[model samples]
Target: MSRTILEVTDLRKDYRQRRGLVSMLTGQGRVIPAVDGVSFYLRENETVGLVGESGCGKTTIGRTVLRLTDASSGRIVFDGRDITTLSRAELRPLRREMQMIFQDLDAGLNPEMRVRDILREALTVHERPSDAEIAGRVRELLEQVSLKDSKLANFPSELSGGEKRRVGIARVLAVRPRLIVADEPTSALDISIQAQVVNLLRDLQKNLGLTYLFISHDLPVVELVSQKVAVMYLGRIVEMGLAERIAHQPRHPYTGILWSSLADKQTTEVTRRVTNVAVERERRTWGVFDFEQPTSGCRFAPRCPLYKEKGRPAICTDPASEPQLRDVGHGHVVACHFA
Candidate 1:
């Protein structure tokens, strides 16, 4: 049995949006839950992919896991210890165990700093090593990330997109983190470069026994790296299971639409159905104003093709009858009523 290294229970992150001049004067703002009641666990040395559309709170979930942003309310347990309420002083030591790889290397890396300086600084912050050890460690990290020593003196601007990302990965590894929250690490790279980075990450995991919470909007990349997959929609997980099962035989309608949208051929019956639904809607874009925001019930029901095909069932719209995740079989869970 795999040991659970990280567990998130009923995690929620809400942002208070400024209403307007009128509401501001009235002292009222709306609370928007970016992540609402999400729960999952990651096993040691395993990769769990959190896949969702752009604005489905995937990135927020990562940030909250690392405590980069404060969660509204939830339990974040790391290594069997509750970290949700840990003070800054208490969390300082635990910081070395968790790290995050950002989606944009430009934003993550300090453009003003050279690669050597960046790596050296990260190492110094966590622990004190002798000068000789620091130098040897730097070389080892560069070799581990497959970057040449020549790039050490180069600034972020001087490196290619792929090289910058490699540097980002190297910096993360310098801390010897046990769990890495990789948020779309290859989204900015070319297709060929993306594959190289993905392979590098996989190899590193095998060699180092690292656990990863890989977050991405790209279905194929997620499938390539993940053993398990979670599909989120509108701040909630709609489906989750083994990576192959979720990819080829998704139980939720939203997952089907996402799979069909990325399909190379619409030959299968399910693919045909998803393709039709895709055509009906213009294109899925993330924003509060894109579709009617559901106050309750199934949040995806407003845009779900199955809900429409079923003549807009009352259960879908009723606020009192919120759907909970149920196991279909073999640990495959879906939140859909019709699934």
Candidate 2:
């Protein structure tokens, strides 16, 4: 197997609302727990999909991992180096190896700069490139993202939404980053354009050997490109397993509901098949998890459909010890109390 390129352990980031004079006087200051103890791994050339609803900490996790936003706590190990505490000067050289594709293309790109200038600036930031070399690299990066190098001379306004994002990607690729923190790469794209970008990313991963932390709320899109999938809810990964396995059999309720799009195969099948699958689980045990530093018994208890009167799931585990990810064969690792 390829070496692990990125490993995040108990990563957490909190966005706080500073108390205004009025709120501070009234004592209403609150810190939004955006990313609370989310963890996963991204191997070389592997795509790990992070899916959750808006405000579930998916994008915050991506931004924090790449250091676009400083993390509140937890370790971020990349390429065998701990970057969480590296000073600005120390982190400068390593910046070239890690890149990000922003959710808002125009927001990240300078409106004052043309496409060529945008790509060229990235090259200049890292080192002094000859004019000819800079121009050639710009053209190459544009082609890598399936855009004409001629578009390089155009302004951001001259391109479509998809094309603008492609340019943003081109600028990042121009730096030859080994790991990409892609924040909703296709969110602004139309359905047809979404597929094109997804396919382009898949192809680029194979060619460049790039590992990705693909952040999105769309389950189907995440399923298409990721080898492993982690479901996040209110800043915690409630379920994590192989993409295909988790798609087929989700051990967590949040996972089951969020997974309907990608893993609804058994769910949409004949009623008998679904009954047998759900009933067959009675013979086995599953693991369980309780989010630390919360105000309730289970964060999902408020919305869970199968939750019982006494606060236990109808078809779930209640293990007393911390759960371990165990293979149910076929590379599926479920973190439930019963398993």
Candidate 3:
């Protein structure tokens, strides 16, 4: 078995929201739990996909795990070392081994610098390589990410969207990172370009033995790239399992609804897989709930079709009886009262 590379335990990241002037004056704000008790692990050279709707904390979890953002509570273990409380100086050395590919195409690229200069900066961050060594590594990075050497002279503003993305990836690779948190890497690309980038990522992972915490809303792509998929809802993972099982045999109602909705969108018709008239009705009527005013018991109970199908069971709404993730079988875990 491959060794576990990253382990996050009950990770929580909260952001304080101050709405009006009165709240800001009083130095008081409502705490919003962006990542509420998220826990998962990634094995060496394996990919674990984190999938959810927008604002469901997928990006927050990715950032928190990399220590790009501090966690409110919980532990983040990277390469078996507890880095949750590591100071900036201590974390600096570890940064080379872990990196994030932001969702933005131009995230790491400096507009003022050419692609070659940008890559040189990343290569020299942790260590001072000689000029010759830097030149050689720069060539290798461009080849690794399938970028033409001629494009190295162009600034980020001169490059196309796909070229900018490739340059961003090359910059990350210059550090020789083992674990990469890819935040919606393909979301911003054109449909034709998306496939090319996806293939490039897969090839790089296979050749370099890279581990990834792939965060995206594209279910099909997640299923393609990830060994395991954890489905998040309202800042918490409600279902987690092998990619195939989570896609086909989802236990949580939210998971079912998610896949079903995707199917509806693709086929442009009502999906009979996991949704019907009642579920559609519930989805249409479901009210938006946030972390500030979380509902009692299961946060998903308000929009769950199963809750209504069971005639509104009190346990599903009881504050003391909130559902917890329990092992079903074959490493599948779900948080539902009647899963």
Candidate 4:
């Protein structure tokens, strides 16, 4: 196996909500586990795709990895260093080794600054490079991301969506990060532009030898970019393994359901063959998830179709102990009783 660039172990990030007057008096409050015990590893030059529903904590995991948001518990080891509890001052010098590509290209860029200035700022912030070096680096970054020199003077708004996204990639490259936690990098663009950005990202990864934690709900995009795929639900990863296995022979019901929903003919047929279960009719909400942290057992049991089809079995709902990810074979692991 190649060197592990990023390893997240039992990572959890929770948000405590304030209570109203009546609720406060009654001692009622809620704790939402935005990222609950998500564990994964990204090897050097690898892209691990995190795919899930909108509120399934994909973005939270990305942010928590970079310490953009403080984690509630667990460890974040990057480049063999345990940085989970590193203070801001301690982490400052390490920042250059990691970066994030936001979903909103323009929002991440400074509207007031020109494209060249933005890239220059990234290079200047971490080290005292001379003006000549900064300028040369800026031009190199633009070329690396396939941007033209004319774009140097353009503000974020003046650029096309694809160009803005390229600029975002350039900014991250300016610091020469080893691992990038790209949270929906292509989410906001049209289909054509999405492919362009995806190709650009892939090319950069190949040439720069970058590792990526590519988080997105777009299954097709993830299929193209990732070597491994992790399917999360209610803040926990229910299924994860090699991308081809997850795509063609997903063991977890949630993973199967997601692939079945894809419109592509090839994808639909492959999912149908691997999972045997036909997509459920009357597509209502699968199950309800309460606001507070779940006590135990499989968090996805309530919404799982397999649970329902199996007559809501007690083993699934009240598992003897919380289901842990177990290897089925070929490095595929699933966290469900039936999987």
Candidate 5:
């Protein structure tokens, strides 16, 4: 059986801006919490999809997990090691096991570097391969991503968007990473091309036993590839469970609305008290979303149809509390007071 490859806990990142010299002196910079106390895991040959609205901090979670950027707080355990506090030197060697397939940032590659140079740069960082060896491996990696070595001589400007992404994939494969964090790999491409890229990733995963943290706002794509799905909103995961469970029978009001709209049931002509009760009850068995998204009660009451007014932010603004990710019957989980 595939074993767990990654574990995350209480991850939090906050960005603060200095208002002024006086504000800096007074320690009054405004704080924006991008990701707050989030936890999840991914296993070998397992794909976990994170879906949320833009600016909901889904991207922040992926980057922090890879240490592509520093995190403000949290523990990230990867490949049986806690990477949260690893030094840059320690992380450098671990690069062989961790890689990222970026969606947009790699698009503007230098027109000068051949495919060999780009792939070789990664090889040079961790291992010492002779020039001839690098050339041979470059050809091999490109072929794995379904590209030609001749295309290696070309620039990013010369390849189609899908092809460029394939090159990006090839670059990661060169390092032989065990866990690949694919962040929005298909968002900017046409639907037809998105399938190609995703399929390629899936095939690569099956062949290599790779673990994936697939982050995107695309719901259907998440459903297709992810064994489990985590739904984020305003910097917290509001709901989580099997992709099918979370997609078809969401318990969190926001998730319900999201899934409903996607399922073409958003009209609410007969607003459900909840319209998705059957879905919630099913999730009750699995008890997903057991913890409060916010330390407070409801993070989604403002948009929830089943919300009951209460006292304090801890009380009033707080979301539902019960329905831990207990096993309902199927492998499903949901979080919502009612669920």
Candidate 6:
């Protein structure tokens, strides 16, 4: 079995919201739990897809795990080393081992610098490679990401969206990172370009033995790239299992609803059946709820179809009975009272 490369335990990241100057002065603010007690692991060279609706903390979890953002509480272990409390100096050396692929096409690309200069800066961040070494590595990175050497002279502003994305990826690769947190890497691209980038990512993973925490709302792409899929709702993972099982045999109602929502966009017979089974009981309006004033039990209870189908069970609403993840079978885990 491959060694576990990253392990996160009960990770929680909270943001405080103060309504007015009075509240701010008085130090009174509502705490919003962006990532609430999330836990998962990634094996070496494996991809684990984190899928959910917008604002469900998929990106927050990705950032927190990389220590790009600090966690409010919980442990983050990378390569069997606990890095949750590492200072900036201590983390500097580890930075080369991990990196992020941001959602923005021009995230790390400097508008003032040409593509080659940008890559050179990244390559020299942790080491002082000689000019000859830098030249060789630059060519290697361009080949690895399938970028033309001629484009290296163009600034980020002069490049197309796809080219900018490729340059951003090349910059990350310059550091020779083993773990990458890809935050919606393909969401900003055109359909044809999206397919190309997806294929490129898969190829790079296979050739370089990279591990990825792939975060995206595109269910089909996530299923295609990930070995395991974790379904998140209201900042919590309600269901997680093998990608195939999570797609075809979801135990949690939220998981079924997520996949079925994708079915609405595509007219496949298999997805149609999934849509019918998942949303047939979904009659309640999905009202907006304040994160600060969370529901008593399950955070997803307000929108959960199963809660209504089960005749509004009191345990689901009981303050002391919020469901926790429990193993079902075959490594599948769900956090539903009736799953």
Candidate 4 residue spans exceeding 4 A from truth: 20-27, 264-278, 282-296
Model 1: CA > 4 A from native: 19-27, 264-292
Better of 1 and 6 by TM-score: 6
Estimate, for each residue in 156-175, the C-alpha lDDT of model 6 and write its tens digit.
Answer: 99998888889999999999
lDDT for each residue of candidate 5 in 1-339, tens digit (9 for 90 to 100): 678889999899987755888567867776778897887888888999999878788889988999988889889998889999899998988877888887783552556786666777876878899988987888778777888667877777787888888888887888899998888999878879989988999999898888899998777788899999998877888788888788766666678766654554334532442456643443344323422244445555544555532222344353455223344446555555555
List runs of model 5 lying over 4 Å from the truth.
18-27, 105-108, 265-296, 308-331
TM-scores, each model vs. reference: 0.92, 0.84, 0.94, 0.92, 0.82, 0.95
Q: TM-score: which candidate is best?
A: 6
Alpha-carbon shift of residue 146 in model 5 (angstroms) = 0.8
Model 3 clash number: 0
Over the full model, what C-alpha lDDT does candidate 5 score relative to the true structure? Answer: 0.76
Q: Quantify all predictions' global Cα lDDT against the true fold.
A: 0.88, 0.76, 0.91, 0.86, 0.76, 0.91
lDDT of 4 by residue, 68-174 (tens): 99999999999999999999999998899899999987866999999888988888888999999998998889889889999999999899989999998888888
Better of 3 and 5 by TM-score: 3
Q: Score candidate 6 by lDDT.
A: 0.91
User: On residues 39-138, what C-alpha lDDT tens digit does candidate 2 reach at each position?
Assistant: 7888999999988888788888988888878889999998899988888889888889999888886866888889888888888888898999987887
Model 4 lDDT on a 0 to 1 scale: 0.86
Best first by TM-score, ranked: 6, 3, 4, 1, 2, 5
Q: What CA root-mean-square deviation does each model show from the true structure?
A: 3.1, 5.4, 2.1, 2.4, 6.3, 2.0
Runs in model 3 deviating more than 4 A are 19-28, 267-277, 288-292
lDDT of 5 at 68: 84
